[model samples]
Target: MGPASVRPAVLVDFGSTFTKVRVVDLRDGSLLASGQAATTTDTALEDGYAAARRSLDPPWDTARPELVKATSSAGGGLRMIAIGLTPSLTVEAARRAALGAGARLIATYSYELTTADVAEICALEPGIVLLAGGADGGNRTAVVHNAGLLAGSAYTGTVILAGNRNAADEAAALLAAAGKGCAVTANVMPRVGELVVAGCRDAIRREFVRRITASHLFRDAAFPVRMPTPMAVLKGLAVVSDGIAGVEPGLGTVLAVDIGGATTDVHSVGAATRRAGVVYTGLEEPHGKRTVEGDLGLRSNATGIVARVAEDPGLATRCGIDDLDRLTAASRQLAAHRSTVPATADQYTVDAQLATAATALAVGRHVGHLTVQHGVTGPVRIQEGKDMRESAGLIGTGGVFRHAADPESILKGGVADERWPSSLRPVSPKFYVDREYCLFAAGLLADDHPHAAFALASRGLEAL
Candidate 1:
């Protein structure tokens, strides 16, 4: 590495609650600086962006930064509606496909016969409506029903049909004939239980692109709201894996987990692996992130954590019901409700425990409940046949890890994310989520200064 004191490029992430800034030295991969500011995107986009940008920018008097870039979940991501014939099967498949494409699933319905339901879906005003139902050899009633619903709708959004391959041509024509603008794809639930998500996933992406042009990002065009932040992250991870083993390490392999408030996302990369995916989200439930325990977020889903953990035997003992109740209550206002600074030791313990459980559950689900941990491991990289010890890296992101009181406290929080924090003690470890590190910012770092991304992620992030 040349001069370690070189200026660094910055990555900025504007979330609903916090706007994070991270800097990575491209020459040496050393993380330079990170900071956050409360975000109030709901108030107004122009104002929100102005404040967020200020929060992200280092003191003007400090060192002039290399470059500043950004991504945001503000103004809501892309929104979507999934339509299928069967409530659980095809509709579920459509939901998966939509979510994978980075669209937020707002509603799903199957077609049996429902004029009222059709009216309801139309009123949701989704950016995209994914229509899927029946198998290639199955009945057309469900698909036709959904098509009929969109026939006279005022919504001019993209409608992707991911259903029976045989009916694709007909479905396209039908939806169009019904005055619905539509895109057709093979069945998301192709063969009985088999899900052909690739086609629909592609269509969803197309729809996002089609809609992004008009979103808040562009004042002149339609914008995509409710687009899958996790989906984009997954795609970015795939890009990294492809570049790593295929480009950098030549025979690279890796595993990743993005522990979020509402969900914990897992992605893997390897030579043997052909692609990246969200292996699981709420894979380990009643054990999700503490901050987002409910559908409401820090501002809305605060009560979810308490409600979920209430069912767990672990929380009951580790954190008394009274404490649990308090945190659960506080989580709702987590975004902006600043009150009651943690004073008591027990309060601190509970706060740590709640964050800990969320992280562990997310991490565990990402790696899967490994019956054995001696497969492969590494520092910032991994290789095939390495096993758990060979996992190139275990990256942690999100606010919980970032706002941790200290590194040791973060480690304890890691233990909570994982039932056993010591599970991977022998492996090289570092965490990059401090008041100073942001993954999206680091992801920007990971793009050019991967080594630095590795370094900071190792040092600042809590290691179990």
Candidate 2:
């Protein structure tokens, strides 16, 4: 490695609530300085970026780095709509790709498009449309039909065409003829039970960079935005699983839970293991998997959580929550003040309870559930999600896990809840927290400086 300050780069993540900045020594991956400021949504995010940049204490006075890399979810992140042929086949694959690409799914449609669907699309006005249908060599009718519908609609957002390979050219031509922007990627479901997602994921990342760069936030910046915050976190987790520079020992299989204001995202990277008597259905699970639960968040979706808990007597009893009005009041208070620090132990407990509920619900949805089905042939046990029983590590990110008074206990309770379905839960995995919020920065650096990214990520995380 060169001198400590030889090549320093600034990493920034623009969250909806805060703008985080980290100055790192590219030569050694040591964090030189870090700062955070309230994210400004009224004006260009550049204002908040400038504030965070100026807030850094050290190295700023001595070293001036020209290279600045960033990721963002400031303005509600990336919203997406998915259209596909079958609800359980290609449509499900498209949904997975959209979430993996760091997008919030506003809506999903399968089979033929209707006039009502067109009106909803116009109303939602998503940033991107993920058009997927049919296997690579199996079918083409649904994809072609959907392409025509989009081409004739009022939607002008970029369309990522990832359907049957034979139908790709026709889909693109249809969109192009109507003067609509679209990107053609590899088939998401190349075969009946196989999912190919890397192409679509990369395409969405490129589109994210393009869309953000075109906005007022980073339009004048020297370099384009790298990836969405969630996407970068997912990449960083992969780095954690796969050893960097062939030196660090790999953490075999790991799961990460991020509890945020508007969503709780769960990511797991593991080897697919088949149970003795269970049968896998639909597409096989990817080695790296991500599932986002928008209805399960601490702040923005707290009301939903409150209602869910109230509806379930057992869950409410376990959470020690009663009085629906009081719970709703607390949820509203936290929602209004996104950055509120718990003033008392009671306040802290309430916050931790919310976090625990969010984590459990999100993780349960992410992992697969088991069901017994009696088909014409015979009885079979079918699994619906990625199994994580063999995960070697469990990571907790976001404000609650990072800043809570007793984060360790909160994470433990969330992971060990029996209320969630038992098909896919971590089995005594090592727990860690991203205390300094370096996961995204590490992910941004993973491609170029694997070893350095590994070092930076390991430093910010505290193994529990």
Assess each prediction's global lDDT (C-alpha) against the native: 0.52, 0.82
What is candidate 2's local distance difference test score?
0.82
TM of each candidate vs. truth: 0.65, 0.93
Residue 213 of model 2, lDDT score: 74
The total number of steric clashes, by the backbone 3 Å criterion, in model 1 comes to: 52
lDDT of 1 by residue, 363-416 (tens): 433333222234355222222111233444445455444454653433333332
Top-scoring candidate (TM-score):
2
TM accuracy, model 1: 0.65
Q: In model 1, what is the error at residue 151, expressed in angstroms?
A: 2.2
